[model samples]
Target chain A: MVKPETLHAVLNAKTVSVVGASSNPDKTGYQVLKNILDAGYQGRIYPINLKAESILDINCYPSLLDVPEDLDLVVIVVPAAAVPEVMQQAADKNARGAVIISGGFREIGNVELENEVMGIANAHDIAVIGPNCQGINYTPNKLCACWPLLTKRGGMAVIAQSGTIGATMGGWAEDEEIGFSALLALGNKSGVGEIELLDYFASDEETKVIALNIEGVKDGRAFIKTAKSALSKKPVVVLKPGRTRKGAEAAQSHTKSIAGSDKVFEAVCKQTGLIRAEGICEFYDYSKILSMLDAPLGRRMLVITSSGGSGILAADTAEDLGIELKQLSTDIKDRLKEILPNQCVVSNPLDLTGDATANRYMQALDVAITSEVIDCILVIFGDPVHKASDVVRDISSRTDKPIVVAFLGGGDVEKEEVLLMHQAGIPAFPTPERAVRAIGALLKKKNY
Target chain B: MHKLIGKALADEYHLNEAEAWELFSDYGIPTPQHQLARSVEEALDAAKRIGYPVVMKIVSRNILHKSDAGGVEVNIMDDEGLSEAYHAIIENVLAYKSDAVIDGILVCEMLKGGLECIIGMTQDASFGPTLMFGLGGIFVEVLEDVSFRVLPLSKEDALSMIYEIKASSLLQGARGQVARDVDAMAELMLKVAIMIEDNPEIKELDINPCFVFEAGGGIMPVDARVML
Candidate 1:
């Protein structure tokens, strides 16, 4: 029953308005208006401010009613108490959606004011994003309604409960050049909640994978149903903080005495086909790996390493994660032996020693990718190797199988190899354990 | 089934063992054949009818843990042993709790030893009814070796929940022991799922030490504590 405004109008509004538009470049109002212009939004902009004749060289209106035409979206950056009036005005002017970037409201326990704004938005059929939010974006549409800092468009969509965390994740994606299709922040959640947004992004062509940072859910059953439907077409990675005792202390289960637990959430994810990330870092790690490749058919992983220790560590982590490490048969071993040195161990963690070169890594990768048994490949490199970047190139072009790499140890050589893989659209981690985790996210046998 | 549970909870916070067994039986769960006896004479007669050697335990609404308070007596070989044990149970329970109200003694045929497993239901405020399955016995929770899934469970979910526990190997016959009946256990789980699905007011259900016999022997719910 709580359907949001057509996401098309909210994300790709042709006629936008910025109420309480600021002339000061340092203010949030100014940043929001500037970001829209900077993101190249090819739409009409109206600055609703009585004090300014123009903002960012765009003509300004005294109020929403003063505008000559209906608006598709409105970004409100006024004080909290002033939001309901602006919302009422936007509704009167037939604005389809309002992205309120103001603070106060339910976030500070001001439920009365939040309710008044929600009532106004609902009555006028105005879909509000926030009263206190970090704002939102749709990079493909060049609609950056969020902060001025922006990244290009990609297939991953980040929906986080904490605006700060969402911004940090967006920044990391920008830094790593991992583009995002959409970045939606949930402010006090007095407006549209996560479930409504999930339904919108589930079918969004630009969003191939959806990542969520949730503190808690208001409606468990509805959330599960929404997530379950979304999961059929794309991967939904969730990160819910506060499960430990310390985490529990911050939250009180207002329901029953048995208490709410992360275990039940974990079990729900297990049943609903959603992926649960243990930490913030793992959320992006999963997104990076998932964005790079499709889901593997089976959990059978093949580890190809130049160092024995890294290989063993990967095997152990893979086993702990319940991923089956396919033991290379003698026939496959013989094929590898033809290219690797005599001292190389032709086993499951098919290690080609410390002195092994990129040729050996590629030979093993080539054989594994060609094997009918292997479902995915995990390549590890430590110490010196010949053209580590070449291994990434061969894997990226030669095979359709999902590939993840671990460039172990440090130094410019190792760092360069990791960056090279990222540039080639391959997910590479710094440690063997991390690489194994990345593979586990995509290659696990039983998923929701 | 709800009426039975309601009547049991009419004046008490919990159900007596016999009433709980009735609810389990209504859901297709098997229980040992037994009858309640109000006196030593009735206890001896019920024992004879049920076919001794039998188990005679105090059936009191106040006595939550029967065995702990020396309220249970087993292996009644004859009328004399039955009479002696019946009086001893009453005396011991009254001594344990001076104000305790003794209902009667439940006389039943002794069950053979089998694979001990446990099944339970706890209503999480957020998730509603959740079912738990693991190695059965009183200390099941202390071991903390259990897996849970929100109900109503499908046949597939029920089967997986059974083996998802670490103690599942014991159910399949560990250390030369006879392999217990797994299908019977899965069936029991589904039936329990149905029972809870019909009633949401049920706060917790404790059916510990469910005995799963050798293949084809079926299963039995030995003890239960149904709370509202």
Candidate 2:
């Protein structure tokens, strides 16, 4: 477990000092300070540089001790050997937390130097994020401590092993309109890693879902325990790469040969209730749905599509992913038949026909919400249906039942309406398979 | 620590097949009734006590792959057959590994009419002790249809491992076959979990071809191996 005070100081620090802050835009130190300024952080920003008197129009100090006020957090971007001295300076200045963005530590086999930095932080009881990480983003406070600045704010908190992947998730949030609460790029992980971050984000009120893109865990047992604890409060979606890697080399038994790290990681996910995403798209798609909608009452999905082909695609994907598509009972089928056209099918997919209008969607959605059998609904716009976004917005606001939309093949209409659906807090996918995959992510929560 | 494991650890060698079976019995993991026979007379007596249709395999620390070395003989239904099997195993083992130290033969009741499954444990670098389960033989060798759960496993975790494999449907009486004793398999898994947790000295364990019988018939481990 992470110390509450440490997490609080790192995430909600009011006064932050950037050690090794530079004047050149090409340097990482300068860009970090610029990102902090551009994020419109309400807190005071202190830039420390030995060579320059000022950076980016802000007065710069020669050392952390030269700072006028007490520092709550320190962002260090100095060389690996300089990090220990900066940490010592941070300790003397009574900084509560530090984010070390420099990368020459343990990653490059500089173990002794990294340990020396850790020793300083530990001795001072100061919480440290990394000695070799990209940095962090706490959107609620408009703090973009890392590079490749992203300020769009919403609900999901992302923690990734690679900074590029973290930025990619942020990019997705910016494009999809479903933003993030926080993002932490854990490089080398010499200090705080996934376990501590998971413990912190699970209780974060602003965070509705936690997304993790990790290569491996340091301690599997500790991870399992922390993940289980987090799952009790909010959903955690994880994408663990290297599923094809073989087991350890010193295998003596058949069990050891097959109990590869990937297989064990899968088991850990299953036991801890972590939603395991297969790819980057699924990771974001899962998080998007989790951050937006509540878990449906059950797995029974009622897919309302304008085309049979789209409906079939949904059924196929849902089947592959273990999302149930039960046949509609005769009573509900008859009710749907009365409102639906005679040519429309009264099945689980409930093909509304490619020519079906937006009004037909509302009718089917109405029957789905009232029906005790239908736990969730998937709406597909197969053509340029008029008022499709309006139908989705009106229908979603009217019910608590989970709803996902696939606004594909509607040309410019879909391109516009999909954005509207996202703004309405309704998960909308560009394809039917992706929409069904999103629904599958929501259904995974109930089993654990 | 179990004396067998302590000895294996001190000697810096894996436990023989018979010793492995004994260690499994000590942990309450079900094993077939049997006894180590040092002589032809002892082999006959052991076969009579364990009943007809017995399995005889060479027990030697030097020879880990008994079947591959032609050190195993099965279905000895009479005293004559048991005696011949006991001698043949010794002869075949010597031919496979000339300097192998023969530790007598393991004569045990032969299992019949059950699904072959494997349940074992190995120390994982990150996860520590992890238990694995899957269909035995070709399924585990070729298809790699296995599932793992890190110890100490809960009832739910153990049960989930049993159903997580690709061939899990076969345990549920797929087609017209009677459902195998999944509860028994789950129970055995829990026992193995506890065993592995209590004995960290156990570096690796294998119970290949564990016979899982009909719904109420229970499961029995036919062969076992332990590396300390």
Candidate 3:
């Protein structure tokens, strides 16, 4: 375990300095300085550039020694060969932490570079984030230490080994309107890796869910321990990229990482209660659902659909995916039978048949959701003829049970209904399979 | 049961073919019909009664690995070979076990070739009574491909064990070879596991070359050894 004082100084530092800050806006150093100011961080920002006296209307210092007071953190955005000297200067200035947002270190297939970078960080007694990274972002603290374009909020702590993937996830989070507590691009992971970030997030009161996009894991045992501890507090969703042999080799070459056997990793995930997402989209999609909705108590799914064919397809998919099509009790079935014609299928899937209105959809949901046998309910709107927004509002106001809405068509129903449902705290997916998979993941997490 | 033999009841014992068959009958493992012979006359008589193309071996309590010690003689066709083999067996058995008591000889019908396999049981420290199944014969150790399940396994458990081994694909008709009777093998392994679990005093048991014939033909235990 890292010391609490050290962890605090690294995560909650007040003052920050940008070493190797450039006057050129095209350089990464200038972008780092601009992002910090744009995020409205309350900390003092000092840009250190030897050639220029001032950059971005802030007076620039020639070196770390020229800084007058104790600096809390230093952001290094210089070339890989010049990092050792800059780190030596940060050590002299006693900076608490440093974020190395430059590439061409150990990730460039050089062992000597990795050793030198680690040596510098160790001698300085400073915790480093990355050598080839896109820095960190803490929304609540107004700390935008990354170069990615994103709007920060407080819900999840996103950790990724690849900077590009982390930036992409940030973009997705912004577009999806899901807030994030912290986003860390753990490039190269020479000093600090997922285990440290996981430990930090395990006790963080602001973080609700941890979304990780990993190409490979360094230590399996430590990961299992940290993940087990974190999952006990909050849900930990992982999207491991190198599942196949070819993918594992590619990941090894890309990050100098070791990818373990996929079967063993799957078994570990099952044993440790870490939810494994299928793809990149599902990774974010499931995280959104888990964060926004309540966990279903059981696998008994009650799907209410307007189209009979869609209802049957949903039923078949549920059965194939090990989800039980819950049989509505006698009272609920009798009520549905009285409300509908004799030709309607009044069993588990409760098909409303064609030519259904908003009131009929609400009636089916009310009847299915009140039953004691059903654990979750899926409402599929097939080519909505009535006002879709009105039906969504009525369904959202009615029940507190976990509901996933699937919009079949492509027009306003998909765009408007999904937004209304999302805003109402109910997650909506485009297809029933995705919704079912997300609900299944939530149920598994709940039992775990 | 012909009073069996004195060595068959000893604390440390080895049985010849006829005595081993009697012991196998006692344990409910089937063995081929055979007879024992003492001299050249008895050898010829046993051969004629058991039919032609019989296998002969020198039988002694002290000599367990008969083939390694040159005590086994196979496919004796007629009286001339039987006469020469009788003297050869005596010489070999006497040379192999000079100080021990010797049984005369074993003459039995030759078994046809089939898919060979091994089934055995050993007490694991963590989980007791581990049953093992693998491809048998000389290649058993070389291949080192095997599967184990806890003792007293059900038929389903036995079938799962067979499918668990890495080389199980070979038994499932790999390389255009005929598939063996795996169901029969599973049943036999389950029975053996149950027997071992029931009789805890028996420390180790090996049924090597449990020849499993092609489809529709059942498996049979050709040779077995047990230790307490």
Candidate 4:
């Protein structure tokens, strides 16, 4: 069982101490402290520095023991040798958690030093995030321990082994206005790692979906077990790199020749119900779609479009991904034909033609949303259509069925309308194929 | 089973061919009927009992790849053929490894025609035991077309792993060929899973060219190699 209190304190700490606080703006120490202040964290902040009287306009303490009260969390950004001393001082101050954002431990042939830090943290009941990492960001509490302040709070949490990947995903979310609940960078993993973080995020009410970037796992069975339990509550999207590394270089048998770590990791994903993303784009795409909408009841899909070419592209991808583009019954087709234009075709991808209007889409959605045969709907906007976002938002609100929209070929209109659709709680894509692929993530095959 | 594995680990690096077959038979995994012979007379008698068109293989503790070591002879028709093949196998084994201890020869019925497949188990650093399935021969060796599942698999998992490979259409009777026995294949996979689950000491195992007969014809493990 995972004790949530330890991580809870770290994410929602009421009192935090930044050891190695710097007066210089060029150092990481200064940047982290500045980010925490910039995020408008309501918690009491303390900067520990022996040489400086104050950092970031906050009074400094010579050591953690010099603080007047107990600390909930400690942000350690000192040199390698000084980390253990700061940790000891934190233990004396009864700090419950610490995020050690320092290097020169375990990663660069310094095994004994990393082990010493782990021993101290374990003995003192301190849940350390890293000995060498890029810090953390929990937006809900306004705690940005990370260097670059990112505070767009949403439903997705990003946990990455590489700090750059974590920041990249966070930046992408901010650019798209997708937002995130938390962004954790795990480096060296000297203490806490993905397993513990997964357990913590699985129960976090703010995190509806999890995006994990893993290089490798230490314990295979434990990872599978934890991932399985976490998946029971929320969807997990994993992006694992180095898929082509030869784990069978010295294999002696036919079976061993083909058995690689990547293959086993793929098996792990299948067994645990974790969505394995093939690349970084798919990782973010899957995470966004899953967090935004409830999974469709079945694979039966209906594509509505204004252009035949974009509709064809969506249909091809849907077929490749095992999503069925079901044909409409004559009765339903006749109903759609009565409301649509003469050039409109009442088929799957129910093309509304080049002269399509918002009313045409509203009418088409009225018929498709009520059809029992259609499980999901994909609306492709190939040309600029007026007030289309309002039509989609109104239609989507009436039913619980998932609706994905693709805004294309309209240039500025596409950009503005896509943002509006997203604001109205609709998943909007820039291309038809991408919208279909996002739908595919929800209906992946179950190995069990 | 414990005693056999214990003796193999105590004396040699892996289980000899005869011991591996015995282990498979004990677990109810179907293999071609065979017997181990210590001498020429025993080889001739074993061939007579198993019938004509038999295959002979040299069982040695030193040689792991029997085919590569020239320790296998197939297509024996009668007594003269068995006699010549048995002597040739011993000569080849001796040539391959001068200090190898010959543990008799395995004489068995030669499996004729079927869709060739391979089932195997290998230890993963993080995942422990992982099972693999793919088409036999060049398919597994060159194309590297295979699907894997962790140990302790369900019936659905077994069936899916078998069909996950790109060449699975062959098992469904591609181009005018008769469909292979997929049910038996899934059952065989389950049995292998159970066997490995029960015996964690097995570091690796390979059943190459496992013949998948036509529907309702069942399956047979033609060659098995077990490493401790």
lDDT of 1 by residue, B142-194 (tens): 77788787876878778887787777877788888778898988998998889
Task: Name the lDDT of candidate 3.
Answer: 0.76
- Stretches off by above 4 angstroms in model 4 are A246-260, A445-448
DockQ values of all predictions: 0.46, 0.46, 0.04, 0.48
Candidate 3 lDDT tens digits, A346-406: 8867787777777887667766767888777888777654565566567657766678877
Docking quality tier of model 2: acceptable
Cα RMSD for candidates in order: 3.3, 3.6, 11.6, 3.7
**lDDT of candidates 1 onward, in order:** 0.81, 0.86, 0.76, 0.86
2 or 4, greater by DockQ: 4
List ranges where model 1 is wrong by over 4 Å: A251-259, A341-347, A352-360, A383-391, A408-424, A445-448, B5-13, B68-70, B95-102, B137-139
DockQ of 4: 0.48
Query: What CAPRI class is candidate 3?
Result: incorrect
Give the range where candidate 1 chain A is weakest over 10 consecutive residues by summed lDDT: A250-259
Better-scoring candidate (DockQ), 3 or 4: 4
Return the TM-scores of chain A for each candidate in numbered order.
0.90, 0.92, 0.89, 0.93
lDDT of 1 by residue, A292-313 (tens): 7776788888888888989889
- Candidate 4 residue-wise lDDT, B1-228, digit = tens: 467898877886798878887888778999898999999999999988999989999888888889988999999999998889888888888888889888899998999888899999999987899999999998899999999999779898899998899999899888888999999999999999998898888999999889999999999999998888
Clash pairs for candidate 4: A303-A349
Error of 1 at A170 (Å): 2.1
